[model samples]
Target: MTLRLAGGIDVGSCTTKSVIVDDGGNILGSHVLYSGTDFEGASDIAWRETLSLAGVSSTDSICVFSTGYGRNSVSFATNSLTEISCHARGCLHYFSGPMTIVDIGGQDNKIIKLDQKGLRVSFKMNRKCAAGTGAFLEEMALRLRLPLEKLNDLAKQADGEVTLGSYCTVFSGTEVLEKIKSGAALDHIVRGLFHSVVKRILEMDTFTDTVVMTGGVIEHNPFLIDLLKTHIQNDIVTPPHPQIMGALGAALYALQEAPHNMD
Candidate 1:
């Protein structure tokens, strides 16, 4: 029996992801890698690797779609779609209704809303600065002399509140140092930093109804979700594979656009 395959490659500011889906939109295989300075190269690496893992050959007539910051740079893609649209579609697959999606990525943060029909109602994004992004958290981790992987664990052990006033990456790093100098516990500062990320997203706009969080930052820092729930006073939803949602959405698009599937 021949298997039908559809693929998506999402090249973001810091990472690239690829996912392959079957005709029914079930994920078959996926891969993720650092984007580095070589967006094109990283995209190629993710794209080919995922296909190989799925036993799908590049020579086959499989459909591939690309999305994210470097979508247009994916020269071999059958088509390119915007990251915002792809993210909304991907989240809808998991949530299955009208909802808001907050995607915190390496360099930017996005607030998107989808209606009951899966149509984009409105959207806002923070790309002008690094504040409240994955980069901001990494910078804070360095300032505290903590390994990036330790941030979540440290946040879980906060002794007291230590809110950061500044949102700029550089300014926040300075604030972290000042808090340290003032004898703030390391865990307190880390938890405060997590709160700051949630604060920045809340400041974006009031997300209505159900809110689903997606992206690499949300996947890595599970503590932020808890903090978000505390601040928003509502339960939050997340996909099992949050980091690759964009690529999954893209693959779904590929399936719809493939010649055999098009009505």
Candidate 2:
């Protein structure tokens, strides 16, 4: 029997991810890497790693789709789709319902509305600043001398309340330091930071009963779930592997492109 393969690559500000899938929509292999040096090089690395994981080579795959900020720079891609479309398609494939997708990436945050069929109907994205993204949290972590994974749990333990000012990450860091100097409790300050970022996301004006949040930050940030519920008055859903949604979405697209009988 001949093997059929298709692939998708997503290059974001801080990471590169790719997926390889068979004609049947089964994920044959996937990989993630840091986007170092430049997006083009990082994308190439992720594509190669993804193919290797699937025990296939780029020459063996018939179709390649590139998404994310660096999609246009991946010359090997047969077609380029915006991450918005690919993410929506990907999320719908897994959840299979009418829902809103909240994707918080390393550098940006987006809200996508999907119909009952899992098709994207509308979307809003905040990319001009790093206020509500993983990068913002990383910066705060560095300044607070706290591990990223511990932030959510620590925030949940706050004994008092504090309000963080500024949406720009750098300014927020400065504000956080000032609060620290003023004798603010660490947990309260941390929870305030969560509120600050969540507020920026709320400004997007997108609300839905069923919402799914994905990305690296959400993977370890339990505080965000409470923050989201408070702002949207809705529960937030997260997949077991929230960080891989983009890559999975890309693979779904590849499956739709490859024509063959795998079942």
Please give the CA lDDT of all the candidate structures: 0.87, 0.79
Tens-place lDDT per residue, model 2, 211-248, is 88887677678578788787676667887667767777
Flag regions of model 1 displaced more than 4 Å: 261-263
Residue 217 alpha-carbon offset, candidate 1, angstroms: 0.3
TM-scores, in order shown?
0.95, 0.88
lDDT of 2: 0.79
> How well is each residue in 33-90 modelled by candidate 1, as lDDT tens digits?
9999888999989988887888777536688899999998887789999989898878
For model 1, the run of ten residues with the poorest summed lDDT:
254-263
List the RMSD of every prediction in angstroms. 1.9, 2.5
Once fitted onto the true fold, the runs of candidate 2 whose alpha carbons sit more than 4 angstroms away are 57-59, 157-161, 259-263
